[model samples]
Target: MRRELICVVQHRLHDKRMGDEVMNIPRLGVGLQFNPSLMDWFPFLDQSLDALEILFDGMMAPLDGPGLMLPTMVQTMDEVVARFPLVGHSNYGGDFGFDELASTPAVRRHVPLARAFGVPWVSNHCFYSDDSWCDVWSSPLQFTQAEVDRLAVRARALQDAYGVPLAHENAAYYRTCPGSDMPEEDFLARLVEQAGTWLHLDLHNLYANAQNHGAAGYSITRFLDTIPLDRIACIHMAGGRWLDNQYHDLHDTPVVEPVWDLLDDVLSRAHPGAVILEYETESLHHHDGVLDIPRSIDAILADLERARSAWDKAYGPGNRQTTRAEAA
Candidate 1:
């Protein structure tokens, strides 16, 4: 039963009849997170960028507001997609790790907005955001078979409803849950396989987890090896700061040297469709109604270009061909 379901989901996602309307992200191109606050900076951004990953949470209003009706924001987003291709990434209105019933209301409403902007693929973080409700981001999910199954179902439902490929991102956990029955990588592998969904592998998230909790032999390479590389459609790289003696995926700084090295390792093995330089400028807001992004933006784009140059050197230009097993 599970095998049949997996094959069916995969077939629907890869249906070629969907054609160019569906995004085929470049294999070695730089992407940035979409921020309406940075409209002034867009003119200065490198023209070589391949795509934009929009966090629909900020782009659109909550589902309770008349079903996907953010007229002004939708107009802004439409202008963005008109100029560049877009990929969707969200926390699913703060309940991403839960069951479909808890998540689908928001995901369903978000799809029309996404389709309006011509977003072809979307991604959700693998974590819960309900309990604390204090932080800007979500807490790590509890790792167990039940949680895995719940996320798998939600992943499939999201892709089915959107009629576009949806990928689940790995969590950047500071600590492992006591009740975890399996390794985080193993749980993610099972979840992706069960849902037959793609992966939005966040390299910096994996790096942060390794730095914080890998003292007990939790190497990032081992974690990478456990995930099916062929299932990866997008790769994310970000920078963060050390808080309370633990490294967090804060997206506040520039890409560190360690993450740059790991990007090389990832490219040597898997062929992801697009690589994104994920940055968050929400906290940098000033009284002038402008963001403090000049320095950081330049740095982030340079690093992304560096990654692009390195990928071309190693894998050659546009080496996206993959075998059935690798892509499956």
Candidate 2:
């Protein structure tokens, strides 16, 4: 079974890589957080999307348990992979960000998906996902060297198991963990260094952090300047809503203007492998019982159009890497 699975995995990976080659550098795309109601939007999105970032946890089944996914979920995911350049983004049950042991379960789930899709890369957040102790606040763990070592071990393990490159994203935090010495950007740099993983830079997360926690003379530009651009594997651009005086990483909305500017800044400095527009629609149902499929699709297409326009201006046909002064 393992040998057969390996063959299947390699075959799929080859097919997707071929598609990516034709598509060329810096794939413009969106997240496919699978939902029954969103099926109608796929045909429209697949028309132009260069790739789809698949949430790994959503497509799995236990194969023998009650909480496990239905058998058909695998088949459905296979269909989705065959149609698009799919990248795995593992939530990894949230604890992996702090402890290497906690990452094992999440990595086990991701390995099969990586093989199934022939994914070239997989990514996860730099912070924990489930917080039993702190529910009211966005409490991101401290930027400590111990955390960096733990994250590196998990990242390397994932890359080995998946036989693909791995990346970890910088998460948004409303409150800093007590007694952290390193700045956020410096911590990211160290983590990438130790893990030998690429950076899955999430622009909106930085937008939120800067808004809520930025220090004096601090800005997104400073944050960008702190990290090595060459390590970037992909970039996530999304919108958030301000709730209770904090910017939430809620994906129900379109890409806001400030996030776009940050994306442009990154494009100017580095040529990332992909730029993904993340939109979550499950939350929309709360406002109304039904999902407005067409409206949601239209909004993303519009957002992608704006992104393409900005992308073209910054790193389009010419590979323009001019400073603002030069462009002016």
Candidate 3:
């Protein structure tokens, strides 16, 4: 019965073909999260990357005030867009569930950058981060029908504002928030179904959640089975560390083995538009004020190469050949 229901929802979501036509977002292939550390290495790494997931917040100045884009940053962005396709990522966008007027300012700032990059879609965390409500960086949403309905309205408005699709990433939380009526997967399924938003599925976040809460009923397979896989816009792969016996989505290390396995599993089931490696450059800099450029570049390139290889395995010439034959 559950499987049948999942099939029904999947069918509904896919039939709509939600944002592809409206946004004109193409299959971006494999890519990396762009950071300042990688600027000097682009010449060497261009061929290995298919697209770049850019943080729009990073390009702006005086984040709290009227945001400004300097000429130098614009030049840098132009160079990046010239070389590869780009996807916009928002780190500080307010809660999708918040009142539209309160969230609009932060959300509105992403539009120009998205247009400048010509990104097919823009993405943000599923959790809320409005400073007025919380001092912490982010907090998980209460998985309730009411919240889903509210988020749906706000998400659609955001997409309309950008004139492109908006995707929300599954956030990694240490503890489930109280007063949630349903599981995260169900919440996401309902949100996407009602809101017409895409899922910027983060494999590391899923892995972290399952690691911390699997005993209580969270797992990768279950999540994949539940959500509308057809709506997954892209995948985020990153590494984290174990602290206090809980896994953290640190994005400061290389891809872990389990995440790699998860990537393969997701690719086999869902064809996301892109796969991106999110590695923080600060992790490569020593506390002694030295930057290990060579080592940092190698680690990033290695993970990207692996992601590309998996992407190729899933959609390369052999798969294309089979697809063509089937079509014929």
lDDT of each: 0.67, 0.65, 0.73
Count of clashes in candidate 3? 0
Question: Per-residue lDDT tens digits of candidate 3, residues 1-328?
Answer: 1344334334433533334476644676788788665566544334545677888766765546654564457656655655666788876667464545344434556775665445778888887766453533447888899989988988877787676778889999987878898999999999988987889899999998998999998877878899988888889999877779988887767787899998888898888878988876544432333346667667777887788788878777433222334457
Q: Report the Cα lDDT for residue 109, model 2.
A: 57
TM-score of each: 0.80, 0.78, 0.82
Per-residue lDDT tens digits of candidate 1, residues 47-134?
5456777777676655556546456664555455445556777774443544344445345456765555445677778767532235
**Regions of model 3 farther than 4 Å from truth:** 1-20, 37-47, 63-68, 95-106, 131-136, 282-292, 318-328
Q: Cα miss at 233, model 1 (Å)?
A: 1.1
Ranking by TM-score: 3, 1, 2
Clashing pairs in 3: none
Which has the higher lDDT value, candidate number 1 or candidate number 2?
Answer: 1
For candidate 1, the per-residue lDDT at 288 reads 27
Worst 10 residues of 1 by lDDT: 319-328
Estimate the Cα RMSD of every predicted model relative to the unseen true structure: 8.3, 7.0, 9.5
